[model samples]
Target: MNIVKSVLRATATTATALALLAGPCALPATAQTPARPAALAAAQQAKRPNVIVILVDDMGFSDIGPYGSEIPTPNLDALAANGLRFTQFYNSARCSPSRASLLTGLYPHEAGMGGLDSIVRPGLGGFQGRLADRAVTIAEVLKPAGYFTGMAGKWHVGAQHGTPPKAVGFDRSMFQKGGTYFPDQPGKGRTFVTIDGRQARLDSPEVGKGEWYASDMLVDWTVRFVDEAKVAGKPFFLYLPFTAVHFPVMAPADEIAKFKGKYMAGWDQLRRDRFERQKKTGLIAADATLPDVLPEAYDWDKLPAADKERFDTIMAVYAAAISRMDKAIGTLVADLKARGEFDNTLILFMSDNGGNAESGPDGRTGAAPWGGKYSNIFVGLNWATLQNTPFRYFKHYAEEGGIATPLIASWPAGIDAKVRGTMVREPGHLVDVMPTLAELAGAKYPARFDGHDIRPMSGRSFAGAFDGKPLTRSVPIFWEHEGNKAVRDGKWKLVAQFGAPWQLYDMSTDRTETRDLAAAHPDIAARMTQQWNDWAAKSFVDPWPNKVDGGVIKGRLEGGKAPGKGKHGKGKRKRAAQAAAGA
Candidate 1:
């Protein structure tokens, strides 16, 4: 039955891809059914093309220019102009969970990544960084298929040495043990770990110089890897999870200058302008109502002179970071085209999570607690609101602003340029990437590997959508990271934060989630809540076993607290010790 299903799926996919290539054609016998391509049917399948998954950190749905932000993301805009861009995609509400699900094709908890700031420790059950040994990563699965896999940028899933990218199957890796940026650190000057069996810090002092932009560093490495792979005649998997535009707002001074006075309009006017652009560009539907402007907590007109100056500087720096990242992406794409590998390479770009609102309305300007080495400054809620544009809440919540992200997939060989301007409204999530990539690569997903029983991937392949076919998720999608829970079935999404009442939305009509349908659809809400609970239980979602004395977990800048001080103090201390030992 599985084999039969697979064959039918392949046939349908081929037809869809061909139909896209042939332009408009007569409707198939069933309007809902996909059309198969004759060329794809006759062609013998070749080895999988190289996969480049570029995951950016803390980017909002509308932060990119194509998505209606004022930010100049020309590179991302170009990708949208030439490939498939998704409008109704979702991700876990926060970082680690999103990365975990993207890599393992399972909910974060199911993959042993369920909380924030929890480093993964070896031999420790239910801690972050543990990839459930049972779950197979894309790198591991692709290794046997003869693909050279490499990853750079953030690796938040685990900080333990043994579980770094190399252990999971990457032949090469240069990644940050945690999500951070440090322009002052010595050597790679960027606090990063290089894993090729053993974790070693890169000893390149050039990394600390003001001239080094982390985004460019990652892209340079990617280009080198691509060149090497081509020379070796091998397909490669380059997982570039960039930390650009995250926080401590660092970017080239020139990039920062481009937007010097751009954000003088403040978030209020900036958000309004972005919404208008979204409507004009067909990024959002014409009838879609613009969310009410967030009420001003502080009267900007009445702000003290010093306060105003600080606010403006932070916003400007934040914008600069985004612009610089965009420029770097353009460079990477250009390199691919120059190398003649652009057409066939499948490029997937998305954010690890939504815009961060942690800085509050006032931006944070100080050395990150882990020391100024990891970050120089932090942008708070005021800028976060602009980043999240047209959505409510921010990172760490299951609201649209937190989980919704722009997903761009570009491949000259697979996607139709004519459809480049179109948006796929079908609801997709991070977990879907694994299966989608597997189908595209014709890679097999094993039931068991490395002496552990693997859980079947909960995500269904979305390759069908590339050809304009509707994607049917086999299981209701679920999420449970740090008590931010949600369940999506069809167009309806049910969600709740820790200690909050469950809220529901009809994603088709209310993707921004301004309306709470829980009151109108009690029965549907009940079903979704029950499903979320069931899935959460199966995935081992639980609150931290210990509590901070004042609900304060020490910040890394303040010398992160040792494990086991407050509630789960022992657990925390043990994990910290393991992290120190290079677990």
Candidate 2:
């Protein structure tokens, strides 16, 4: 909770310190990244070959068609079919942190959003939910390098009380600051669509009486921006974070009907079906086994007819949402192809994290969390367990199911065709995104931005893998969301739930984490334990309080001056006086 005046400047020795902490920068394009194509000169790359990062929110490992879901995601599937699908990619186990890491090129904690923008103080680095000035976003980095950056959809990384996307560097944006299942839903509509700095009222026309859906709105804005970029003939960096397939599921009526009874077969069979498809598609080994559902759901057949019907419709709605999102993307890609930008566009598709098992305010009180009669019922735990398929657990944990994300990279002009439509299993994480894009765009991650020296980005460039090169990593990737912690080094991964002992597994063999080798390999466990502890200490890890202990719900930002206790009160009163005078 150490909020203070924004002055965290790095000293003259920052580069040396950051370099030491960051180890080595993954450069030269040959050892780590793919060698640059001779024909695609830096000048040529400097202009065209746009970058499009499509972020899917709260999606599971096996949700889309390419990832072995029955849901039709032809556009996403085409990305996998024409590009490279990653069999072992990772997210930061939740929404905000993942976005923070993806955009910042640092660990989420380094970006000051170790958690959502909920601002729960004194609970580790997560409570400070916004992009720290030091960790400049890709938009920030690329803009000065001459890329027109635009963002659409979720901006959960900084809900409000932080530097906005435009302030951080997006030139134009159509950002729905948060999300709504339907704009017409009661207590809905809170999008902030801006051209430059002026609000365009994409939130609501008159409040609760409109034809608006988050997914469609995002696509609409994205298309408009892309068209503008094309007209301008500038290589644009489009970060379209989709709010689809999350919760309070809403879709067009026709799309909803298309998925009616789709999940009537129930969770049991759906899990097996998706897993088998994954195996066949070579996304997983043929011998991969379906994990036993955690908490063990009741048999679908044993449920009452009414209850069964409810569950079926719930899943159907979820599937329909995905289908609807895919269709919108199809329209976008079609538009891109028509505009002749499809082939040259570097499209990266990713999910924030695995399936969600969260029960929103609607479930808790029979009313929407925002105090509305909303029908966007959470998918709940049973279906979520199935959503994760062969993986275990759900979002918010450092398990495979929580952190694993489906990543597809499509670039007709860049990715080698021989590797197109293939799967790359070399492990990578969200932190790799900024460095990868920086290398691709020839953009420099500044040593300094806004008075603060950047923490040297803690990711090896994975651009080398674009040309079918095996992605290599010399350093272990680490994770800590809430108190859930883990460390992945090479083939061995040591994971643990909050307040639990570490469980070691050879991930190359047990990617599903079906067996724990910690008991057998005492020495390895002890060594990795120390390694994880060192990582935790260096990575700004902090103590997380358990709710049972009754930690403070919210507290003053740490290191901030006391409200009326010093000279701070004068500023607050001055601001209040200005507002009182209508200024």
Candidate with top lDDT is 2
* TM-score of model 2 (CA atoms): 0.84
On a 0 to 100 scale, what is the lDDT of residue 253 in model 2?
Answer: 67
**Error of model 2, residue 96, in angstroms:** 1.0
**TM-score, one value per model:** 0.82, 0.84
User: All predictions: root-mean-square deviation over Cα?
Assistant: 9.4, 11.6
Q: For model 1, where is the 10-residue window of minimal lDDT?
A: 574-583
Clashes of 1: 25
Tens digit per residue, CA lDDT, model 1, 1-583: 1334324333433444344333322212112223334423321154356789998888888888888987778888888888878887888877777888889887777777775435544444445555766577887666555567888788877645235675676767777633344444442324445655444544355233344667787788788788878876768888999876666556655666666666666666777888889889877777776665343223455554555666676677777777877888889889999998888888999987777756344446664221133445566666777778778767766778888899998887776555655678777888888877665654556676644678777676666666666666556777765456688888898988665689999877876788898999999999998888787667767654332212221222122322123321112222110001010
The residue-by-residue lDDT of candidate 2 on 349-468, one tens digit each, is: 998888876641011113322112265556756677778887987777788988999999998888887888888888999888887877766565777765667778778777777777
Over the full model, what C-alpha lDDT does candidate 2 score relative to the true structure?
0.70
The runs of at least 3 residues in candidate 2 whose Cα sits more than 4 Å from the true structure, single-residue gaps closed, are 1-48, 120-126, 188-200, 203-210, 360-373, 547-583
Looking at model 2, report the run of 10 residues with the lowest lDDT sum.
574-583
